[model samples]
Target: MSSSTVKTIQDTLKAWKSLVFPTFKVNDLLYFFLKAGLAVSTFALVSLFFYLSLSHPSFNSSSGYDYKTFKHLVQQRTIADASAGAEPTNVSHILFGIGGSAQTWNTRRHYTELWWKPNVTRGYVWLESEPPEKENWPETSLPYKVSANTSSFKYTCWYGSRSAIRIARIVKESFELGLDNVRWFVMGDDDTVFFTDNLVTVLAKYDHNQMYYIGGNSESVEQNVIHSYTMAYGGGGFAISYPLAAELVKILDGCIDRYSHFYGSDQRIQGCISEIGVQVTEEPGFHQVDIRGSPYGLLAGHPVAPLVSLHHLDYVEPIFPNMTREDSVKKLVITYKTDPGRILQQSYCYDLRRNWSVSVSWGYSVQLYPSLMTAKKLETAFRTFQTWRTWSNDPFTFNTRPMSENPCERPLVFFLDRVESVDGGETRGSYVRYVDVSQKECDREEYVPALAVQYVNVSASHFLSDLWKKAPRRQCCEVINGGDGVDSAVYVKIRSCQASESLTPP
Candidate 1:
């Protein structure tokens, strides 16, 4: 009785234990499934939130709801009910800060010619050195107003080092003088000159009302620099719109004591802007080409067809030693001198434009070709153009059908009649040869005596007269060409030559 009873009791106890505790395997499986479901739900919720915020107009940043005050303003003005005809005020202004060494001062003149002259009305110039003791200074005969303001620091060790202090003073004074109309602040070295004629017009087209900052397209700033979440590269030529500028000033004013120890002005500015949670607009065409060891191209973006500006920081004196008051007053225009031979062979043109009115001699020439080639002659030309045309480097390129694409065949004639022959000695038999990229081979022949031809060949595919017609007329050298290849392709060539003796009327 005891043995049988003991076995039954033991089996009963085991069964009871199994029912109460359950299997370890089952518990583990259940726990895993529960956690997986929770994780999936959490992820889905987060994704849904982001998606809703991104796609729906109510949640979009462009919608006023993204910011509290912006929303209130829009509501109060009944902007939501307004028609499309309502135009918002464009609140962008160009602010330029000028200071530094004699070279820096000279650079300012070029900036004046390129940027200030064409675009902006107000700017600040901080004199690094006392203006040749007022008594010894030359009489003020320039067209633009030149004011000499003293700096707290007598001598700045380097341009970058002193930029912050100079900028601080200029910014503060600009704000105090009720000059709040400025929406963008452009800070750069003095020697910068714009190569392009249409930079201001282009910028005006794109300056939207936002906290944006544009910089020169250079790797140096991108890699080595830490920009504010909202701003970057205060040097070279950089622009910060009004709202950003105002916000930056507020942050700087509040945190000046904390960031005072930072040596780099750009770093300090970036740090402060980032701390405030602003976003930076990495734009092309703002640069500090004057910086030592910088790239040959514009730092901010692609090159423009016309130059915006160039930093003449290095050769400021020798280049403009004889610059006169009259030169400053005269309206300067750039005329491109092209060698057609270079255009056909290299699919590029060696072109140079110089302002005869100014004594400034240091200028850059460009070689431009089609955009399709790997050699990137057009890219180089555009970059060079932007470097001088805009305060920064930016190339404005648009795609269109090339002259070679046309079905009709016509002879491309490059007329040299408008060119004033620099070579006085007249030799009759000399002729110039040019390669025609529009044709498969350079077999086509067109001849004009050396005396009659000023420099190079024009592709039959292109008409110099057409280019001249579209170009700004003043005084220019006309190149004329006609041919079957002219239907689909366009070409530019570069040539080495002395300055032209005469410029044709447009």
Candidate 2:
């Protein structure tokens, strides 16, 4: 090569190195600034997200408060003071009317089955504006004034049937009359008979500070049904607190239009109250006594017995209808020895058949005993053995027994056999050896014999009664009596037996 060409190439190489090396330093500075800016931006975004999440309105520190404190706050907001014209004693009894023939209304009166009347101060009836002209209308006493409103009929198809509308009208009228002070609002159909005297006393024992809506019975709603909420059976003798009623009325008045297509008044009320966040206490004794095949003859240890108001009105001939109001009331008046041995033998075995893995054998033995049997069985036995015992011995006595039979003069006896101990210690055996019999037995005397029994626990009896009252017919077998050492348990099992034999009316 030539010397001049070599010098030109070296000059070009020197110029290119100076420009490229200087630009490389500038690119490094730019990359450092870009990475630092991204890190700072990420930190700021995360901090903002956490702050917003913690400070949101729905997220409150109050959620950590104890249940008692939260409940107190709710009570203060919902319930009014008894002295502030919100006293439960202000009104008594919520009268319900079932829409049907006049004969149905007459049947209710003849039965004298409105259980809430004695507990409440007044009663009201919901009826069609015009009375049905029927042959069976009673000639004597009619307790309630009939109202004639058909606005309820418009939603009949949606609510339930015509009978449900009748109950709704009665409820609406009771509310309109400012009967919220009435502690127990007994609502049900005409066919029902509420006869328990202990209902008011039982309700009085619960803390009245909180607002509650008690239902007589509940029914499941079909999944495919269209409405604001699924329907429940508020028709059969349901009671609600005045505060709950007020809240329900507000919701009803507001949402009635949107749910105009919904027909049943009970359903509408249930939906409205539910939306307002009122929970339902389904007590036993509240019943829907439809005359499908036979009538429920006796009333013994029925849960709703204390708060019952009958519903679903129907009538039948004296002979054809084996069970009469008099017969039921008579059973309530009698006191018979409930044989524990028999109760165990006849009592339906619920846990034994279903929950054998979890339950102890003793629970099974107690649940099926004569005294702890199904409601129907107890009722029938009481009715059949009415002559065997005296009314004075009954806890809730109102009458005496016939002179021909031994007046259940024997003191209540309880037999106890020592079973396993809690810590596997020595077993204990005891029995109520003797109890003095007396005519004036309604007081301490009545319960003394039963109380004397070493094996029988009053609390256990009450618990069993409560379970029998709340459970459905077939479901009664699951109830257990365990106070000695075993924990109370329930089991679901299928029963192959048909309904028990009907009780004979005296």
Candidate 3:
């Protein structure tokens, strides 16, 4: 063989040996660095997670939150703590304390089924005329059935002139029959429309054992001002706990004589209630929609609170302004018959102004957006809200809409799993796999579109409730940025894991 060929082959073999196997020392040193890099990455992720949990609870996945990595933190508190108001103990609840005029049966008959008949589960309709001895009233819409039987109350006060003051007698008469068996006594005029679902919810907030005179104020400042702000307007209806009802019955007779000069039954009742030292604890749902103009104004700004009753609806302006009262009524039936909740929310949710301010501590506020991502008790830069307030004095109002979709409604902070996509105008991201953040089970691992300054109101009362049944989604608004940094997003716990079944009424 040629010497030149052999020399080249020898050199190639020597070079290939070094390439095939590096010295152990060199390889081990290189391996150490690779392992160190991996360890550092793991440490950083752990620390990031820890920081999110402790210091800043809410986080935007911008620092690296993705749908797969985002996990919803388990709630620390139980559902019972969140729903302290609506806990249904062993008490049997009652439905009504209806007060109708004896002289107006013919005129009132049409409205009887419209309001009280369909909604009331159990209670009496106290009428001026002989209470229907027959278990059923003449047929009405949907043929509303009476859970509570009707009974007439006898009174000496003549009709027309003394009709407004008759509630006093009605109260005494109702007291005469013993209401100690029931927990709540709901009072309303025959024409008043009551949303019993909301009424019950509002009542649940307070202890039945405590004297709760729950209701709302009148539209007229003069009326509220003339009477003490403590009085709940009658048209909107009012709730009295068993204890309060028992107590009020005792003083109502004596107080009625003193307030008899008042123009209407409502004021007289208010006077009696107030005299008993049981002032009206306001629940915005009991609206006094007594204005002469369009109901749209009143309906548009309906409170975020549950609706107890809409009084004088028969006497109020057209529900749909510009239409005849009859036409408005027809439209209202059509509008609300299918989904009353949506209709009510539509009436109230739209046309809200940002006159109110809410604080968000942890969520990222995009460029030029209002602050977003507040928890139930987030201490925002504004030292914002203690528990989701609408204005300075109002926790909720028709004029204000809260961000509902963000899971930060609870005081717990949340972190974003990651930004899945950013479209410049809007950012698509996934929050941690939370128990109640996603409204739909389908959307749990999905990417959600988010933007800054756009406050969105989720109608859900709480996140956990959204899972089993339809919850009230808050009004739609914008999300701002986290106060801390661009990488940060609000990490929050939506609600306790406890489901609604836990609070089932006894």
What are the per-model C-alpha RMSD values against the true structure?
19.4, 20.7, 29.2
Query: Whose TM-score is greatest here?
Result: 3
For model 2, residues 257-322, the per-residue Cα lDDT tens digits are 444466556666676677877766755545443222222122222332342444433432121122
lDDT value, residue 107 of candidate 1: 30
Residue 6 local lDDT, model 3: 64
What local distance difference test score does each model get?
A: 0.37, 0.38, 0.46
Candidate 2 vs 3: which has more lDDT: 3
Please give the range of 10 consecutive residues that has the lowest summed lDDT in model 2.
356-365
Per-candidate clashes, comma-separated: 92, 22, 68
Task: Report residue 279 deviation for candidate 1 (angstroms).
Answer: 3.1
Q: Weakest 10 consecutive residues, lDDT, candidate 1?
A: 354-363
lDDT of 3 by residue, 385-453 (tens): 221111132222223343345442322222222232223322233333223334432232111222222
Candidate order, TM-score descending: 3, 1, 2
CA shift at 291, candidate 1, in angstroms? Answer: 6.8
Q: In model 1, where do residues sit more than 4 Å from their true spots?
A: 1-93, 101-120, 128-130, 133-163, 194-199, 206-208, 217-232, 290-307, 312-506
TM-score of each: 0.44, 0.42, 0.48
